[model samples]
Target: MDLNQMLSEIEGGNDEEIERLLQRYNSENNRTFTFDQKEESLRIKLCQSTLAVLRREVPFSCQRTCLETLRIMSRDKCVLSPVATREGILTLSLSQNGLQEDNLSEEEERVVVEALKCLCNVMFNSPTAQQICVDVQLAPVLCGKLHSADTWHHEVGLFTLRLLFLLSALRPDLRMCLRKDCQAVTLLTKMLEHTLDINWWLTFTAENNERVMEALKALFNLTLNEPEGEEDVRQCRVIVSLLRHVLMLKTETVEKTEELHSHAVNLLNNLPVSCLDGAGRPACASASENLKVKPEIGNTMRNKLVRLMTHVDWGFDIMSGCEEEPRPNPSEDMTEEQKEYEAEKLFKIITELTRHDMIRPMVVRPDGQLGSLEDKLREIANDDDEANNSDSD
Candidate 1:
């Protein structure tokens, strides 16, 4: 009936406690109560509530039943409440600490799997849940859980799968580590293919076709561009599918074009030279030199970003002022070597404009572990030793 009652029951394992609290919280009499009390009481309910008791109370003491219940909720709730949800997931994570063989009890494992299923949906669907993943040691601990079978960690796998697939592009920090793990790409590739399955489609009952497409887009970004692996060429072909879909949308107007463009840039900014075939070569002409630029990744990512930002135009300027008198055309007088040097410089300008902020959300700054983009550009310059050596013995 009150906050104290809700906490006591939830802690004592009264399965019906959360719903009763929610029902009471939503009732006419409850409207007069202070928001704080209602919010406070809800947190306690969520903290104590397990997945097994979503809309029902405990029917048995068996752990398997409890685990199964959690899974049911995972398939049910798209938006989990903030109060209990965070604690619910952490508590579920902690439960694995009790495993005898360093793996969860089958039922306990199910609790985590379903709980994460619910958590991932909220993490992506609710802004608050997204914050909680970062705020409460969720991501790093998740990384640790993914470290081994001792983690016998299953749910976190699903969570990481969603996080890596959806959040990797927006956050560069995550991108670097995702590249560290070999399984990151393999798991994502497998999941992306699963999207075609009817079983996978049915799992997204609460998610509409648009959200599904966005998920597909995010998944492509993770696989196609963020990480370069043996499968990159194949993945690129699959990723190209998105370009056609977005272009075909006659109903998609300019309202979200800016946001979409930013996403597009994020996708393209990471495109390596390897993605380019004969046709894509011009689009990826700078990539051969990029490998020379990136020495070590972490130490240089931000620096690479800087160099990219400096070289690429943000498309903010339209007018160029000329103060010098026009010079005579010098093609006749210039040496072949000199002419080649100027032509190389022109290509760098084209490369920068093609990948600039106006076209993509690439923010480049200079300095750090990786060599600057300018340095890479210089290496790719026609005057670089590689170019000169290829011309002779």
Candidate 2:
């Protein structure tokens, strides 16, 4: 196959021809060439052709095929170099144009989805491409996509947001830009709350679980080291929402629940540490004042967490209506794996909660009607020590 000539044909071809070319490239069974320099050069040419077609005022169908081709081409790192080049990034203008249209055909919408995915692929580990995206004012376009009523739009929006978040971690300019955009903060926070919804518990799949975790991670990244960002997060009540998410995780299997629990704790830890301001200042004498939590709300959340910490077991057992006496050996029936996982999550959550002044007392109080959370920690520590001793003997 004359790949360069084929790419040229695809770029200028009619809609039917473009679709045929895209399908040919998309089909794995049709691939027979070795992954040598020739093949790499072919992929790079295809990326160029895809961008050229996208940049032109073509039929929407041709544009859609162009995006599909770009997506396929983006999978190879050699192709990605061309895709992120100055000429290649101009295709983002086309993507922005299509996404701005209020009325798009199903095919055009599909193209939009693929375009976002292609953008994600092109920018992966490519800081130059990420900068190009920011230079082109892509964040606002992505933030706009998040507001669409369509679920496909939301899904791709999240995928793109995940990429942007990764980029922001290494690019302080992008991070500040996102932090200054109130819309970005609002959208990310709303996504977090929606993913943390109880409805997800009933309709959960591994895919949705992963998406939720990604959303949390993105939100965490957005809030990192920015006092204004943290304030925006506080207004969203993410602290309370994440706590609810932790409670909901009890419904998952032990391994899955522990994974989600770790993410939840990370998000909690990402919240602005009350003792330290953005400039690393701890001038505030009252830690409670730094938290910005209303007294009643703080007490309520503290009480909920206190209950979580002292519970004999996780999940439904914590909510069981039967008032059975506390087990003398709660760890007896649990496998060593389950015991370690359970203890780690509990300790992490308590440690994060104690960072706030209003919650610290409940966490560290030495006495309680049914033993303090501190008592539970001591018991877990003793069990770990005894287990280690048994192993040695």
Candidate 3:
């Protein structure tokens, strides 16, 4: 029950006991327990001790509980820096000491997953931890997980990426490393393109949605302001693949469709404005003869985006008559503020896409179904000018 007694048991106890002790402090029902400052300090000490054991070769069960305890401890910002430094974040990052996918037991795999999650939790808001992540070259280790054929690995990779995105935003140097040194954009593209099967839509889970959303969001952060970063993504022909994926979402049942849509569209907004050829000239949208996106594919990409922009129910119709209760619209669950922000992101994407000479006319031409976005803009400008003129009088 006391801190020293708890540590003794954890250092010498069996897995069940260890897990029970950890859960006792971490249980959601024990909300009042979190307010005890002394107990919180004890929790940090326990986390440090657990991580110390985690660094060595231990029973797989013990390793898991260690990770689980750390995962819970990491939720407290007060403990994060100490855990990051004392627990050896950098050491755990090395491939030799870290978790791997090859020849893993199911239990071992779960342990690896928990370890990754624990790291994510510690690094979530701690600048020191985030710096250590970059200094230790953690991105490559996480990238390896992204390339694994196992879905669990993919899930872990994305979970880690979400943390890295936050770190990179606060540290430009880390962002550069992730983009240029770690090649995050390229690795994320591969993960995003990992298709399950022809019947993949049916098998998709919340895990899949989270993975793809994080991947897109990470790429968006990496490429947001760096021209070279954006160029690297453009060279990967991200627009073509991203557009196709968005189109496929119509038939899919994802838990966070709005997040996926928002991220995908934001990434599209981040892509290089002009996809050019090697000759230093504007590449024809219809010709993929020399570019990463093929000619025919380009048109299909545009059409798909247009369809999404125009029709909200294009893909949901097929799910209308299902035997089970209809899946709730994720949009309805969103806060009013969040919904407004998401709508702004969509509007920005539509605005940016129409800037291309090829797309502008089609999207805003008179007689279009959505009416002219250009006309709307001009009308707003006129209203503003008239207001200014009247104010002068």
Q: Pick the candidate with the highest TM-score.
A: 3
Q: Could you give candidate 2's per-residue lDDT for residues 167-242 as a string of tens digits?
A: 6555656666676773666676666566556355573455556666666666667667645645664644645455
Output candidate 1 Cα RMSD: 18.7
* Model 2: per-residue Cα lDDT at residue 363: 55
Separately for all candidates shown, the number of backbone clashes (residues 3 or more apart, or on different chains) is: 12, 0, 1
Better of 1 and 2 by lDDT: 2
Off by over 4 Å in 3: 1-4, 11-20, 23-34, 91-97, 149-154, 196-204, 229-236, 251-255, 276-393
Alpha-carbon local distance difference test for all models = 0.45, 0.62, 0.62
For candidate 3, the TM-score is 0.61
lDDT order, best first, reads 3, 2, 1
Residue 260 in model 3: lDDT: 67
- Expressed as tens digits, the lDDT of each residue in 1-393 for candidate 3 is 467888888789866787677666556523441545667677677767776666666677766666766676677777765567734685345312355565667677667677767777767758788777777767676666555634555545555667666666666666677767676777777666674232355644666777667777777777776366446746446644554455457324533655566567767666664642231234454553333222223335444344334323433233221123457888978999999999999988877887665466424545435655677888889999999999999
Candidate 1 residue-wise lDDT, 181-232, digit = tens? 5344334333434432323323222222233344444544555434455565
Q: Candidate 3's C-alpha lDDT?
A: 0.62
* Number of clashes found in candidate 3: 1
